[model samples]
Target: MTSHQPPLWRRAVAELLGTGLLVSIVVGSGIAAQQLSPNDVGLQLLQNSTATVLGLTVLILMLGPVSGAHLNPVISLVDWALGRRSGTGLTLPDLGTYVVAQTVGAIGGSVLANAMFEVGTSISVKDRATTGHLLGEVVATAGLVLLIFALAATKRGVLAAPAVGAYIGAAYWFTSSTSFANPAVTVGRIFSDTFAGIAPVSVPAFVVAQLLGAAVGLGLLLILFPSAARNTGDIVLPHSAEKTSA
Candidate 1:
């Protein structure tokens, strides 16, 4: 938002490209894992989570300079919501563009992943919206939001890349739904009928759960660190104009 920062268009493209690649990594690795370890579900998850962890960390480090790397809708939404009072973080207009870019990037990434794997893009038939899965989404997303903002609030934004990636990797194993905590990623996964895909029918509930989780995360942040909202602009990582140029 400063003179030295990248323009909105450039930042939006960064978000689109970063989010696309992230989903590609997710879907591609899932397909590879399925083929590599055909019978062992645990092995498949291991491969998928490992790739996701590395890929996401790289994406955040690579793109955080441009867009603050708010790759998730809830992240953007929460940023806007929390910063409204402080007049910081993403503006309403920017939030809208970010979400659109993310959603488009997510779908494109899924399709690209299917193409890379030589699999036809089709709606996923994996029904994952069970009560346990929904509950897992809530926990996973709440934890994600809490982690990101907590880092920013504590001036540990430098650790966001690895910390967020590690939390997600752990959540993949602990959460029943494998922590598809992102709404855009969830929607994108609906296009690929792969091991990492989710049923289209489940996307609505998943998105709702994620939104609710964001609220819970914000509530927790306020309770534990009442001053957290003041640093909402730093969510995810520090992408100040000066740092970005450096």
Candidate 2:
């Protein structure tokens, strides 16, 4: 790691904790919205999306200093991929560590949300795999990747917290799948049988769509900003591990 980067263990812990809390915010707020809004699906979505927007922004601000607050597998993978030749982002082993941490954290967050809501950890029966929903996932993930890298490339990474949160909040309404753009969060939602859950059978397609979206986003990012590769290390937000360690 570089001077600005924390050790792998610390970064991993940050990723795990940050991702866990993000899912908790998502799943917990969704459950609350369902109970609070009862029959009004629109109201429930509004409540859920609002809470997610604010909570996600807060999490990114808080954890970005530690691990770039990636909190998403696709972001980490893209960071690694983009910086491979430049050697400015995560290495292959670091990517593996990040993915494992994020996935485990996602599952744990779902379980935590279930417990908090007095619901058991049950597999979601909400089948979300349709042609339209799959297309939504593609769009949602693509937009997310494009936005993050664009900010980095443009030296606007400092605005990532609010910008990303706003984009996701907007996507919640525009997309059919509610923009479960993060693979880790997508898997986490599988453990909840509530409003934000997804059926296990839908996971593969969703993941595939997300990966394809990442590719599209990457292509767009490279074309739009030829210097994106050099700025890959600043994803999500910029922070110094050495500064924090001291």
Candidate 3:
């Protein structure tokens, strides 16, 4: 089945809405998990991860045809880096637009979640700036990017939604920082002083770690799929879809 790619304006709106809803799911579910399982931290995590997995899967499947469902800046940058020369990937202007939309949408999502939960919008006080947490972020993001591109390179793009969701669900449990793999989501989490929130001071280190992880993931992609042809556009677009770079 051929997929119709929307115009840049519509695509950007999809990214904005997709990213906003994704963060709302993350922060909203986290808050619910906390409230539902006040005593058991493990149960809270389980609940949060489950909701995130399901939510992310739905979001990707729903928006992949539109904007490539690039809810993360790193994904957009990587797509641009690998495909810019091919003239099939994202252009410089597209990158800037996607990043801005994702970031602003993320912050809006956080506020929306806070309002929903009757939690006043406030900066997170929970500091997650330890070295171990930073390392965990690096690992989490690297694995995420690797999983995404690997699927694309191997012609397993059809599985991108479920695989990406499953990896993130697992990463939440295994990673020390609970794997805020997306930079936009990380920024959004700062607006909620609830279960999913991260302190403002911790944001910079986490973003740096994620960027480093993206670099690492790109290197690994080169090594692992040396002869694999690069895919154009976003990390995961709907199968057989054609999209013009913004």
lDDT of all the models against the reference?
0.91, 0.93, 0.87
Error of 2 at 73 (Å): 0.7
- The TM-score obtained by model 2 is 0.97
Across 1-246, the per-residue lDDT of candidate 2 in tens digits comes to 336687889999999999999999999999999999999999999999999999999999999988899999999988998998687888898899999999999999999999999988999999999999999999999999999999999999999999999999999999998999999999999999999999999999999999999999999988999899899888888856465433
Winner on TM-score (1 vs 3): 1
Each prediction's TM-score versus the true structure = 0.96, 0.97, 0.93
Query: What does candidate 1 score on TM?
Result: 0.96
Better-scoring candidate (lDDT), 2 or 3: 2
Candidate 3 regions exceeding 4 Å error are 1-4, 227-229, 239-246
Candidate 1, after superposition: displacement of residue 97 in Å?
0.3
Candidate 1 minimal-lDDT segment of 10 residues? 237-246
Task: Tell me, by lDDT, which candidate is best.
Answer: 2
- Choose the strongest candidate by TM-score: 2
Give the residue spans of candidate 2 off by over 4 A: 244-246
Report the C-alpha lDDT of model 3 over 6-33, residue by residue, as the tens digit: 6677777888998999999999999999
